[model samples]
Target: MATSTEHLIDIDRYTGELIQGWERIKQSIFVILTTRLRTRLMRLWWGSKFNEMQDKPGNEEVLMSSMMAAISAINTYEPEFKVTRVVIEDMGPDGEITITVEGIDLVDEALRRLKTTI
Candidate 1:
């Protein structure tokens, strides 16, 4: 039979491993913002911890580049965009992510565009 101290040691090791795994999960969920908009948004979201998450997501280099592409597309494609709030809701899938944005009738415009585009 294992002693109480031995059980406690095993529990501590398990907790550490769980914590590390959770960190990896958190890294995956964060979307990098490359533009000045993103910088401001990140500041609003996480003030002090922004720097910690900066380099972890692929040094935030590739991530930033990808975001820049998206921002560029938004400007080029949707010039009349008057988006007020951008909401990214996780619709629980294996690996599929659904990005939902709610704004001033822009959602309808966006859906129409998507239908035409895709």
Candidate 2:
């Protein structure tokens, strides 16, 4: 069985539930995308990381461009996913960001659409 972060097990909330298949992979990608650069303890607290694009931007175009570049860079040598596209929408009024990730699972070759709100 897969263990630790590599297994896509939900570490928050102590659910003891493992995210399976494509969902697991999707969550992994989400975590990677959300983690601030140089914040993880594993790299002696010095890991090169991607910005989460959460900082309030002056314009939508600026936010979209930052997110796209960071999210796409995650497709590098990772075998878990082959990201086809990433769409980030700013939900008005509620002030939430919706991230839509489209990708193919490399292990089973299944297409996935994952939506995350932050």
Best by lDDT: 2
Q: How does each model score on TM-score? A: 0.25, 0.67
Model 1, runs deviating above 4 Å: 1-72, 91-93, 105-118
Per-model C-alpha lDDT, please? 0.29, 0.60
User: What lDDT tens digits, residue by residue, belong to model 1 across residues 1-118?
Assistant: 1122211111223354433222321221223222223245545432122223233334346444433443343433332333343332332334222343222223223321110000
Predicted model with the maximum TM-score? 2
lDDT of 1 at 83: 31
Clashing pairs in 1: none
Worst 10 residues of 1 by lDDT: 1-10
Clashing pairs in 2: 37-49
Prediction 2 global C-alpha lDDT? 0.60
Report how far off residue 11 is in candidate 1 (Å).
60
